[model samples]
Target: MKIRMRTIGLIGYLTLLMLPIYWMLNMSLRENNDIMSRLAFYPHHPTINNYVQIFTDPSWYMGYVNSFAYVGINTVISLLVALPAAYAFSRYRFLGDKHLFFWLLTNRMAPAAVFLLPIFQLYSELGLIDTYLAVALAHTLFNVPLAVWILEGFMSGVPREIDETAFIDGYSLPRFFLTVFLPLIRAGVGVTAFFIFMFSWVELLFARTLTITEAKPIAAVMTRTVSASGLDWGLLAAAGILTIVPGALVIYFVRNYIAKGFALGRV
Candidate 1:
């Protein structure tokens, strides 16, 4: 009886969690006319036109490409910068090390909105406006701190003896970190990369504020749904559904490592 109750509760919880996604999928298959004309749990007449338009339209598909480019850049930059910083924090004892670490995390705590103006002005001055690099760099400001926080925790768990043994064996610092130390914390890296990628992918404020057109992200482009005829509900829903796919795939591939990452890291 207890097991039955638990099972039923789990099912209910999952249904609640997945309700929005299922609704979005249902909406994506429908026309704006069909959607606004009635309220139905399922699409009475399913259509693929919404998805088709997204693929065929340059404005729509280009948004996706631009988004992917920035996300990839931010993820790589955040991880690359964080790994060394995390290692330094985990391995060394220095003046105000804890204070410095705390300061880094504080950057992550600040809302992205606060940085919007400064970033905009700085990028404008640098002539990086409407570029993939601008958005990627802006995202890195948030992602790097988080990557450091999580990576530091994982790096700390690694025994210092490994470093000593590697050095004793004449392994170079880069070689040891690449071949020996990194493998041990592979789960943490995977989790960090996923997090940075997702944050950059979904973040609209920075992405939208920084780029006008050439580097506009998909989330920002979703706003274009507002037209003289009102919102294109079907098209918007399909884009939303497609937007979710990459994040879903990232989670799926890293599902095995995510648990270990959470358990092992500061996350």
Candidate 2:
């Protein structure tokens, strides 16, 4: 009886978790007329027209390109900057190091709204507004700290003896990190990169304010669909569904790494 009750509860939880996603999928598949007529458990006449429109239109697809371009760049830059910083924090003791680490994290804690004006002005001064670089650099401000935190945990799991042995073998610092240390932390790298990509991809405020045309991200473009006439519910639902793909792909690739990443530094 207990086992049967547990199974039922598990099924119920899964159903609850999946209901919203199923609803969105249903909405995306439904025709506009069917959707407006009344709320139904499922669509009477399903169509792929919304997805078709998005793929065939330049404005819709361009936003995806811009989003992927910046988020990809941001992930790479954040990892490059954070890997060494995390290693330093995990392996060595330095002046005001704890204070400095916390200070770096504080940047993540600060609201994006608070920094929006300054970031906009800074990008304007550099003549980088409405460009891919602007959004990528802005995302770095938050992503770097998170990468450092995640990578530091994994780095802490690595023994200092590995560094000593590498030094004795005449491996230089860069060679040691690239050839030896990096492989040991592959799981951490995957996890950190996944998070940075997910956050940067979905973030809209900075992307919206900093980019106008050339580099506007998908999240920002989704907002433009709502007009004074009425919400473009079908298109909006289609865009919302599409927005999950990148994040879902990232998680799929890193799913194996997540458990190991959490276990890192515990020993």
Candidate 3:
């Protein structure tokens, strides 16, 4: 009886969690007219036209490409910059070190809107507007501080003896970091990269503000679904589903590391 009750509760919770996604999928498979005309749990006359249109339309599909390009760039830049900064924080003591670390976290604490105008002005002056580098750099203002904080926590957990032993064995700084130190905090790196990617990918304000047509992200493109006739409900639903896939895949791949990060890092 207890097992049966638990199973029922689990099913109920899952159903609630998945209801919106199922509804969106149902809408994606039906015509907009059918969607407006009736309320249905499932599509009676299902079609794949919405998905097909997105794939075939350059404007629709390039949004995904442009998003991935900048998101990739942001993640790489955040990690590269964060790793060394984190190492210094973890391994050394400097004048104003505590204040500096707190200051980095302060950047993450501030609202993105606070920096938007200044970032736009800087990028415009630099001719980085409407480019992948522009969006990527804009996102770093937040992601880098976060990456540094997380990586620092993970690095702090490592024994200082490891660094001493590596140096004693004549391992160069770069060689030791890549071959030994980084592997020791792989979970933190996975978690940091996942966060950086998701933040950059879903961030619309900076991406939209910085780009025109060439570097528009999918989130920004989704807003253009409205037309003279009305909203393209079916196409919008399809794009929404596709937009979710990349984040879902990232979570799936790094799921185990995320669990470890929660346990091991200062997440």
TM-score order of candidates, top first: 1, 2, 3
Q: TM-score of each candidate?
A: 0.95, 0.94, 0.93
lDDT of 3 by residue, 5-52 (tens): 999999999999999999999999988888899999899999999999
Over 4 Å off, model 3 = 1-7, 227-229, 260-264
Q: How badly does each model clash, as a count of residue pairs?
A: 0, 0, 0
**Candidate 1 structure quality by residue, lDDT tens digits, 1-267:** 999999999999999999999999999999989999998899899999999999999999999999999999888889989999999999998999989988888888888888899989999999999999999999888789889987888888788999999999999999999999999988788888888887788889989998898999988888865554479899999999999999999899888767756553854
Poorly placed runs, candidate 2 (over 4 Å): 259-267
- The segments of candidate 1 whose C-alpha lies over 4 angstroms from its true place after superposition are 227-229, 260-264
Report model 2's TM-score to 2 decimal places.
0.94
> Residue 188 CA error for candidate 3 (Å)?
2.3
Candidate 2 residue lDDT tens string, 1-267: 999999999999999998998888889887777788899898778888989988899888899999999998898899999999999999999999999999988988989999999999999999999988899999988889888988898888888999999999999999999999999888778888888888898788999999998898887787876653377677778888999887777778888776765553343
| Model 2, residue 142: C-alpha shift (Å) | 1.1
Candidate closest to the true structure, highest TM-score? 1
